[model samples]
Target: ELERMNQEINRIGVNINQITHNNNSALYSREDKHRLYVFLKQIKTLVSQVQERL
Candidate 1:
């Protein structure tokens, strides 16, 4: 009985680790996307300014 309980505990620990890893990856991806969006916006603004000057 004790062995079975230990096995279950180990399995739960592994599942938690996997979930944490997936969450971190998702957060990193979201941050990267946000940064890219901001960079594109800046480029668009610069282009508009240059167009106005011309």
Candidate 2:
């Protein structure tokens, strides 16, 4: 389960990185910004859970 979570975190991070890189060239639409916000929240929640377990 921990391994799976780790993989998920990595995947999310990669997606966020790509989105940010894309945004560097163009302005983010409202939907794009919302998606990024959601992604950040998910990462925060996952990290918090991981820390608790550790």
Candidate 3:
């Protein structure tokens, strides 16, 4: 179970890295910012779920 959580976290990290890279290569817009915020919220929820399980 711990290993699964670790894998999930790593996947989120990769997604974040990709998003950051894209943001770096482009200009920030309201939509992109909002999308990033939503994505981060999802990550936060997943983390909370993992914590609860542990």
Candidate 4:
């Protein structure tokens, strides 16, 4: 579980980074930006919980 969570955390981090870069680049539609933002936040919360489990 910890290993899976760790991999997910890394994946989330990559997604967050890509979205952030795209956001900075001013390329995403407003809705996509909002969705990615929400996803990133959820990923963060999940990572936190996973860390506690660890």
What lDDT would each prediction earn against the true structure?
0.62, 0.83, 0.87, 0.79
Pairs that collide in candidate 3 are none
Please, what are the lDDT tens digits per residue for candidate 2 over residues 1-54?
A: 878888887887788788889888678988988887887888798789888997
Alpha-carbon RMSD to native, per candidate: 22.3, 2.0, 2.0, 1.5
Ranking by lDDT: 3, 2, 4, 1
Residue range 1-54, candidate 1, lDDT tens digits: 656655755675575567557666775477766775575577567556755755
Error of 2 at 18 (Å): 0.5
Q: Is candidate 1 or candidate 4 better by TM-score?
A: 4
Question: Each candidate: how many clashes?
Answer: 0, 0, 0, 0
Tens-digit lDDT string for candidate 4 (1-54): 767767877887787788788899999999998888787788778767876876
lDDT of 4: 0.79
Candidate 3 per-residue lDDT, tens place, 1-54, comes to 799779979998998888888888886687988989997998899799888988
- List candidate 1 segments past 4 Å from native: 27-54
Candidate 2 clashing pairs, residues 3+ apart or interchain: none
> Considering TM-score, which of the candidate structures 1 and 2 is the better prediction for this target?
2
Candidate 4 Cα outliers beyond 4 Å, as residue runs: none
